[model samples]
Target: MSYKLSRRKFGQLALAGTVVSGLSYLTNRALAETPSLNIVGIGSTPIITTDQTTIPEVNTTELDSTAPDSVSTDIKPVGLVLQSLITGKAQVLADKSTPLLELNEIVSGFTSLSDGTLVVAITPITTSRRQATPTRITFLGTPVKTLIVSGLKQNQQLGSLLGTNDGRLIGLVGKKNGTPPIRLVDIDLQTGEISSISKVKFPNDERVSNLAECPDGKLYTSLVGLNGDTTLVQLDSNQKKPIRLGQLKVNGQAWNNGLQSLVCSATGQLLAFGAMRYETPNAVYSVDKNSGNMTRLQDFDTTQITRARG
Candidate 1:
């Protein structure tokens, strides 16, 4: 007495639902100019290169270094989050169970393959998560690749993974204990492997927290000055000396609290970074990568911008 829909009716309903989703997305985007289309204190927003068009998607912890997955841009009606936030569903990974990969056993350095596949740089660890040894980069069935040194390994708790374009892996930009602070690590896209680069030499020796590669391939870093000033730094594609871009200030506010994270958009025009503030919800703002200027893009009243009734 309950099941009444026929196969033909079900197919029609599915198609109708997709159309409705598409329409709702369009309706929501029309008012996208209102600030608050973003989340503060979360992670960076990523826009995957599609055949055409750049869509805003939010990065969730699930897509963090913990899993090998990616969501597509320019391919969907939309998602609830801001990433290349392709609103519909999570992108499929070649191997669902592939483990997380970190840079120098500390930072996360992950990037997508040319076809948008996620490359994970996992080291074989004890079930308890102790680092026994790091393995050469290779997908489970792929041929042996040279991304790891035979007998050298370290801790697995310092850094989170970073993802980049196909040929290159995500590099590290953080400090290492009991050693001169190392700033960056390079990932080999071909081998799913990682290699340490050089530490940034700052006369002031600022405590840098995170680094992000903008769509233009320029690595933007979040540096905290010794004097407790939070600022933005732009590096040459080579990631050498960071040219001081000054602390990110918006609407007459000082960035003394510092940036919690950094992310950039496809055109490099929209750079988003999170500010660390305990009392208020985190803040996400857009920056002009070239001029180092920032615009207020979000705040706690975001629901005033995100809540919509269709």
Candidate 2:
């Protein structure tokens, strides 16, 4: 169920003056404290890869995980909003019985502060829909604090986002009109300011489908080819080009570039959510960093459920 953000929690989030820094929820001690988390396998989903990243073999059903010590804190699942095409609002299915957050602006995407606080990018409810305001809010209440992210231009629109281990926010920058060069931009979470980091020029008009920051201090993005093949690439500032990691395989078949979303779990696992083309239900899968294999955990129909984040 949904609950209000407590005063103690609100006081903990002061992003205006002091810098906010901490680990992601998955890497945080909260999820680690759990004695053990079991994963039920659904046979072997092999991924052919020569990359060094390790992909553990485990499978589990669709799980609704909560904060470890949430009873006293009234914490809720980190929400990822999927805006409806018709209504232009977000809906999440974490707690199916609870109501969704009725946000006022178009939610571009969300990322977390180092301290586990969530920040959202929204195109403000004005006539112009170019730049977005980075916002931090009380999960349960109506108090929303908007921070002025500096250097964001009027022609750039923010897209999918992720928080890094270094306490920075990285996102895709799409042009408001024509096909401007696709680039990865960084946001100073402490200052609410944005800046261009690097240009990710993918051939064949392939854009960043999903992006996440791993525990090893590297950034990864999923790129789909024109032939429907999906490749996982790494963003290395030291290197001159994006390192091609490997291809993502689903159910022993080449995944046809339909990855709905990808997020790095607290424990460093690459969690992916996608539905097959013309498939009735959606399933959750985990990507092995070392091997590009994706094993299906469980498939469930979310026809009634909307958007989920965190």
Candidate 3:
């Protein structure tokens, strides 16, 4: 079979082939660069205690070297649920509910360091109140290292842990018995010491429930009132106070539920786990930083997720 093609025809065919190859290269490059976000969540079932009348506090001050070699006798075993989600999706990709430390500890806070190391604050369950032991900070990895928080007061507990882009760990410290003031502080990863940053003055009835740092290095927090009203506030590092954005709204209607966790993806998308009303299962939402609007993404079953980090 002998077929002769003109010069113009051959040129057209060559150009078409080049265009197809270029398109394929571009597509592959995009896919390689834009990896799916990996969000991790840690939670647990409610802690139940058999003792009611007399409660005892576990002396955590002595057990601060590393993760306990074995589960303490005072611990009432409960499973700690660890789950993961991909970017732009609400469905959990995997639910590996492993009983780390025999599920004897309650996860009070969870966040990732700048190098993607998972850090968790857990308190050993000693009584029904769940407040008889000091909260210890631990790193989750091959060998879990439990570190003692040196500067935290006996009545203060740290929550809403946020790892900043500049490699600093920040958290919200609140009182156990009385109303909590807006106290933001920086925590030392090596020494487990905490130093006070400037305090944000918010309303007495409202508290800074959750905190997240965006890709641009700006910090945002959710102010939740006693009536379940949530407002998004932006904290500027240059200033001492935070700028109130507005009340959070879903589909243009005011959101009536509280946001359990707030996290910003590497792609600059703000995500949250919100407490929906009417007994509906908790769901994930994409938050609008400018207007305080939330768009529901997908419904997730876990309700006790203290925080999520992407």
Candidate 4:
């Protein structure tokens, strides 16, 4: 029961042990800080906290296959879930949270104002008809007031809504004219007035699923094509054609149900949320703005999520 080793061998072994121990500690700390979010229903708000790590991550609640299919393109989102990355909890902004207001319409877009007021674009339950009404809600799901956007005709469905740094809202809208062209509209927070910004006719007119304003003032959005292919694109004002970054490729590509949401992190990384349709794992991936490659950050052990509170 005696162990003997040369000075060099002993030094190498000690260094190896120290490296392993350091890695183990950092790994454990990360695990403890990452929030395990379980969104059982539409109202389950899982707050994401910054105390654990700087990178934003999300988790979803477990559900059975029989769980309601809420990720379909035709399905209108009833409510919004607001999750605070700094706090790591989600506020379910649904009927249970705001019982007075019936959130049965399609939530076209959501963004937070400069003063932290959550703005939501809501359309009719059936389809995009005329002008969709916008509402301002508090972080706790309380309805503050509603803004009537003018000049937007009836049947115009707002696609992607984003709040810019200058306290203005930018959104993608369909005019519902003969050939509805998706255009970007600048919304006035005070008057609820929408002014035409740019007519964005994407390549092949790819339907935009979501839009997020990056830290660098560029618009990043997710586009879904007719072939069930999803991609990330940059909608810059100076560029006539939208810049195609790359495909939002995940490990379980076949299992991904649909694009749920796309948000930009504080550090300017795009976070994409995908719903699991079949027997697959739901995941939240950090997307590369340049390459469109998705790096898996956290796996959600859940089925479907209605929407998050803005």
What is the C-alpha local distance difference test score of each model? 0.38, 0.47, 0.59, 0.47
Please write out the lDDT profile of model 1 over residues 89-156, one tens digit for every residue.
Answer: 22321101112222222112222333323333333334555544344332211211224423234543
Which residue runs does candidate 2 get wrong by more than 4 Å?
A: 1-105, 124-143, 148-155, 176-180, 199-204, 299-310
Model 2 — TM-score against the truth?
0.57
| Candidate with better TM-score, 1 vs 4 | 4
Whole-model alpha-carbon lDDT for candidate 3: 0.59
> Over the full model, what C-alpha lDDT does candidate 4 score relative to the true structure?
0.47
Candidate 3: tens digits of C-alpha lDDT, residues 1-310: 1122234432332221111111000112222333343455555653344777543422222234454332233333344444544433322121221233324455656788786556777655454665554566766543444565667776677777887888888888776432467588888887667888865565667777677888888788888777678899888766666798888988787777777788887778777786556657776677888888887765555533323332
lDDT of 4 by residue, 196-289 (tens): 8864566545566667776687887766665557778888788887778877666645323446667665456576766545534555566777
> Residue 214 of candidate 2: its Cα lDDT?
55
TM-score of 3: 0.71
Alpha-carbon shift of residue 216 in model 4 (angstroms): 1.6
**What order do candidates take by TM-score, descending?**
3, 4, 2, 1
Q: List model 2 lDDT by residue over 12-47, tens digit each.
A: 332221112220112222223322211111111123
| Candidate 4 lowest-lDDT run of ten | 17-26
The segments of candidate 3 whose C-alpha lies over 4 angstroms from its true place after superposition are: 1-36, 46-75, 87-105, 124-131, 303-310
- lDDT at 281, model 1: 58
- Give the Å error, residue 102, model 3: 8.5
TM-score of each: 0.50, 0.57, 0.71, 0.60
The best candidate by TM-score is: 3
Which structure is stronger by TM-score: 2 or 3? 3
How high is the lDDT of residue 195 in model 1? 61
